[model samples]
Target: MSTISAQAALLPTFSEVQKAHRRSDVLILDRHGELIHELRVDKTGRRLEWTKLKDVSPALVKAVLQSEDRRFYEHGGVDWKAVGAALIDRFFGSKTRGASTISMQVAVMVQRGGRPLGHKTFRQKWDQMAAARELEKSWKKDEILEAYLNLVSFRSELQGIAAASRGLFGKEPSGLDLKESCTLAALIRSPNALPAVVGQRAALLAQSLSPGEPGEAYRRTAIDALSRPYRLRPYLALAPQVAKILTAGAGQGELSAQTINSTLDLRLQRFALQSLRQQLDLLQGRHVGNGAVLVVDNATGNILAYVGNSGDSQVDGIVAKRQAGSTLKPFLYGLALEKRLLTTASVLDDTPLHISTERGIYMPHDYDHRPRGPVTVRTALSASLNIPAVRTQLLVGTEPFADRLRRVGFDLRRSAEFYGFSLALGTADVSLKELVNAYRCIARGGIVSPLHLTPGHSGRTLRAMDPKVAYLVSDILSDPGSRSVTFGLDNPLTTRYWTAVKTGTSKDMRDNWCIGFSRRYTVGVWVGNLSGDPMWNVSGVSGAAPVWLEVMNYLHGNVRSAPPPRPRGVVAARVPAGHGEAERGELFLAGTEPPSVPAARPAGEAWHIARIAYPPDGTIIVIDPDIPEPNQRVFFETENEAPGLKWRLNGELLPPGEEGRRWAPRVGRYELALVDNGGKVQDAVSFEVRGQNQ
Candidate 1:
């Protein structure tokens, strides 16, 4: 047997050797700095895990030595006895036995395209031996052993002792048992062997290691251990996000073993994921295939939990743009209230109404297609009534409403005219992230700020709405009595604590959303098909509100989201029995009060007259041809419910003593007038009804 000459052998520098041993792995940590996930492969798709000798198991080191080179500690790199025996066996036409030491294997591992026992020429073999000797001289025994164990491939898709220990044994290298160690050592020769064959080989190796004793039990145990299926932490779902955080944009770098401290709370993340998955599973028969959830800290705007999807669909529901249903109504009403266009006690007509725009004839209807007549602004908003919201939008104007949405962090890429009046009902597309932050804006008392993902992240804050208006809107949303008209007294939106939540469903129930905030956290959830297919009989409350409630309840725990303090410019007024119906309390801007409201008018007085209430001067109401004539009506009301009030349309007298009347309108401009029994015109307004069908 010939030995490699030390004088002719080239040695690698310590730094070069260290660089050769470097492997790529990314570790994702939770907010508390605990490991949540690990990326164990480099960009080149190589499984290189650089483990320190101290972190490696001595048992694995001993097993590798016993399996590959029994005298690894004594040899420079070439085992002359084994090499000579292999050469003589080759000459005699017998099977060749391995004489490659761990150091030689490590040299092969580091060399480009080098592999164990691969095809090679005589000169290449000599060079490999010389390089192994050089490596042994450069690195200590422990380092050499650690490098070999980490660099060598154990089985199919298993590289390094750490990968083998996890991919094969479902554990860290330090936790490998004697049976597992022997089994892994046996796998070094043939990693892709069948489980039964692997068990047999591992059993033989274990018995050979203890030749004199009865080793059947140890062999069976090692074989059994090797045959078990591999297990790993259930963190594969978070791998893509970790990759994005580490390798996207400014973090672009070569893939290597890396540890990233993420802002995720594993507990909360697991809960959110489980909640979404459970809902998806329950609704699977309904063709519900995707869902996402986001939880943010209202104080810091830190995302506490983020579940991108609960199904196999690759779509990211959080950032994907979908229609914002009635979810945008709160902001619309808030804008109206902030402008003092309407007070909480102000009544709006929820009866059938149609509008004409450049787009076509626009007709808005409630979810149930049932009219709620003369409801207060608070109840109208809380019940998510369509007509009331449309009326409020008419008062607030579409341009200003779209601007308000943009100011509050909604991305309204189009002009106000692009959406027209349908904008009031949320016809525009928006992302879950933008919508959640907008709700967080209201939660933060009218301030718009971006959500922070990592610690120490700063954000710019802008006042998007008045704090008093925000407070009033929040109060109205929290009132069970207000929402009871639609969602009922006990639904998923009703929390044990105070939570102002709004639910919305896009056209044909393609997207459902339920977003709200507690005293501390704001959670938003979206459940729908990524393909944009309509859901089967799914409403906003049933589809998304339950998940929102689950996550909100989980976040709040036992604490309640208390009511926000009243802002400075807000006042609570008690309307007298005679002026306001039911004498209920109302919230209004300090200086914006109803004018000239008398407690009671004098009886039998000529001045005690009524004026036309509905179609208040210059009102342009459109009649949709799509709506049947019987379902269409122009309502006329008297300002005061006087007993002798009379109504007339186009100078044609209607029934006497009629305080209010419904005119089944046709396509024409009509003059409406209200007069008392004294033949005095109390009020007169000219309105036009135009019809168009698309």
Candidate 2:
């Protein structure tokens, strides 16, 4: 008796055993406690959450007792009558069978590194029996039975009643019927036994349970239950990407908790996924294969919907870094406004620009390839003019702008010198999550915070930009008239309610992004091929904008999206027509409004502002091998041409022509100057002609 007590002290308590069990999979639930996904974390064995004694089906408990040990309730730990019969048969009878009560089985299960019940020797049997009696003294009958059901293996890879019932019958343990229960109880004896053998044992158990019932009926039912293969039904995979992200590095402690609640709204997640998939279907012919959608509550910065992919690939597009096209324009313009370097009424030249860089002369062009000349900051930003954006980047400085983007959570992963002027055109790579959260910051009046996926998890917020500047940028994006220069009046961007939105298309049409925000929600969508294949003529408006529009519309179906109130330090001022623009009221920072707008140039004032048109500032002329040296001529053209503007090449005055002047090809560096009638150089451009002169 003292030895038995010592053995029981070595074993774990019932509560301790329950606490140590870890489910193989983690359940992800939505904000309202709806199961969204289940991700397997443990690879060794498939054990679900331990089933409690009360939750187990009464029919299953009865079947297990009848099949494994008939006097389970009456015996203290070992069935002495069955044990005596087994001992008598072992020595004198032709057949031998062993009697191990449920308590004894559970005792072996709770013992540290206990051997299998089938292969135990005489000494091991005596120890197991002694431990069983000790366990009965410390653990209640119900505790022993519950531990047995959970610790015993019912089949390959399935270690608990919860896993077995769900794997074999596609239902919870409480929902198990009599025949199903009998089938599972039979698996306890010979786990990997043939289905026919299990069925025969199950039939006998069922017959003993219902002695008045027809034996053949029970046999058929048990056979039907065991004949077919069983597997756990596929989990509710509504948020597989979220599950993957949340379950990363989930150790045994986290797995023991079994379920994690996320801040995702199931209804919104479903809608966003449907919207993305539907948009991908329409763009199928254009080679657009995958896309992602993310929705956030602007106030809390909680991620409401995160559709990582369009069901075609495993890549999580929400966090995948892709080249950010013109999507970063708003922030660039916002930074400029915040620094008081530019205002909404300030005019920016959107014409072709050539700026010298470390690599070479970088040229920026608009999406339409036709420069609109000088445009207001509002129109330039709303229209997404690349040249104006580059000019703005020059004003804000590349390093400062990149730092601002970093403050808003963009992982640029490189120095500003690496990106250069192209940073204004969004040459830097950024993730959709980062992009959406940045937009949410704008929606929240320039305060940037980390987006949360799980409830009660939030990070500190930082002031990324002035609220007044954010308000100004948002107002410009919401204005349909300002964007009409690029996008027409009626489009997916023009919502019935007010919304601030932008679209971006990366170089080669590889990525399309549409990010926007109403008053309460910010929605971002990305459409492209995850395999990095460029789509066929697919722009952001046609690819990602529609999905954004659908989700935004659904989100604001019953809610109002009125324009945000103008923040302090921002005021509306009247501006007269100037710089090829019409007279209108524009928003500007206080004390920065211009007293008078510059007047438009008079008609036919060609000689007033003379600048070279052809072979722009840092031109590189490559001599074609196929063309004759004399036939290859470079046009010496000047904008605002006048009668006295002569073309001077290499400090030598060229002969003036009736129509236009032309220079013959030469393998040398030449400086062409536009000299006025007074012999004063108005504009000069240095160009190099390279090739074999022949």
Number of backbone collisions per candidate: 7, 0
How well does candidate 1 score on lDDT at residue 671? Answer: 81
On the 0 to 100 scale, the lDDT of residue 361 in model 2 is: 90
- Tell me the tens digit of each residue's lDDT in model 2 across 1-694: 4768777887788999888777788889999999888788777778888899999999999999888888988989999999999999988964977689888888887775322556789888888889889888889999989988898888887889999998888899999988888889989988888877887788888878987655565556656656777677646777888988898887544555688999998898999999889888988899999999999989888889989997946689999999999999999999998888998888899888999977889998988899988899988998889999999999999999999999888988999999999999989999999999999888888899989899996689899888878888888888766776788654688675668899999999999999999999999999998998999989878999999999998998899876676656666656777775555556777778776643222222111235577886567888898887778888877654555678888888888783347777778888887776556554566788888553
Error of 1 at 65 (Å): 2.2
Expressed as tens digits, the lDDT of each residue in 1-694 for candidate 1 is 3445542244554456556654445666778977555554444323545667787777766666788899888888888888898899989999988777777777766665335667777877887788887777767887777667776777765677776777666678888766777778888888777766766666676666766645455467556655666544433445345345554542223544356666677788889888988988888888788888998888888877877778555467788899999999999999988888888888899998889887778889999999978888878988899888998889999999999999999899999999988898889999999989999888888988888666777688888889878888887877655687788754788665667888898998899999888778888999998889989888888899889989988877866655566666666555544322345445666666555443232222221124456876567888787888888887676554555657878887876533338678777888876655544444567788887741
Model 2 is weakest, by summed lDDT over 10 consecutive residues, at 599-608
Task: Give Cα-based local distance difference scores for all models.
Answer: 0.75, 0.84
Best by lDDT: 2
TM-score of each: 0.74, 0.78
| Model 2, backbone clash pairs (residues 3+ apart or across chains), number | 0
What TM value does model 1 have? 0.74
* Decoy 2 TM-score against native: 0.78
